[model samples]
Target: MKIPTAAGFVTLMLFCLVHAEICPLSCICKPLGEMKGWLVDCSSKGLKEVPALSVSTRKLYLQNNSMTTVRAGAFDNLRNLEEVNVSDNPWNCDCDILYLKLWLEDFSESSIANVICATPASNERKPLSQLSGNELDSCRKSLPIKCLDFFWRDLALITFAVLVLILTLCALRKHLRKIVLCV
Candidate 1:
């Protein structure tokens, strides 16, 4: 019985060793009870960027990091994510962070209430979850007017109307000249 217990302990140690490689070098990851994934704790690490997380990550703690921006679709592959803590980071509330803001909106309000904007004085300390769609729209870069916005058919119709008006005005002027000549 003692031998079997020792073997079980060795096996558990080996499992933890193998799993250690799955976590980021800068972060500590531990499994939750009976859960299928890890809880990544990367808070207060002064990390400049988000650590590479596995598909098995359930919760991410990144508070008090130096990350000012998060790349778009950064968490797209993490399907099991239940909570993300990104508070106390110097968040730049700009177009770069628009994706994160939109993604936070998908989670429960309580889960996202902790995410606050740290920059753009107008939005400083505001909860990301509470921002309205129109308010969030401020983070998106405005689309420039492109030729595609106007249909060719509409332009053609306007051109045709202008040509007809010019022709009618010219004919009327000619008729008026004739009438003046007759007088």
Candidate 2:
């Protein structure tokens, strides 16, 4: 096969460059493979928010940032994302971050370990991947007051039923006494 001429090679390179996805200005991007897409690195950038990523981003690195919360569906656009690193970030593991916790559980061990929770003392230092979806759901649902209300409602109903039963028994007893006296 004949080697490509300089002009032909330059044209090919230009074509590839034009078709390649551009990484966010705040992060560095490395092309992984034809099907894998770009690996975006936003580590140590002091980012309080996640940068807009290209749909072609396959892997993302956001370690050691100051992100307190990541909104739901933040990664919905990056459907091909395979790996992510946010281990050193001081994550506030509150209701707002519950989605991230649930999302982490869908990955493998290596990917899961890359994210560690920093806040909500109960979950501190825990791998985000290990957090169960149900647990996160519980965190998202502020059900304590509702549960207490149900408890009180049931208690009142039971107390009312018990009082009615006691009153019925007393009335029946008085009726039986009157019948025995008449007999």
Displacement of the residue 49 alpha carbon in candidate 2, Å: 1.4
User: Candidate 2 at residue 63, lDDT?
Assistant: 86
**lDDT (tens digit, per residue) of candidate 1 on 51-113:** 778898998999999988789888888899888888888877766777777787776566567
- TM per candidate: 0.65, 0.60
Task: Report the lDDT tens digits of candidate 2 across residue range 1-20.
Answer: 99999999999998667444
C-alpha lDDT of all candidate models, in order: 0.80, 0.78
For residue 60, give model 2's deviation from the true position in Å.
Answer: 0.9
lDDT of 2 at 181: 100
Model 1: residues with Cα > 4 Å off, grouped in runs: 1-17, 130-141, 146-183
**Judged by lDDT, which candidate is best?**
1
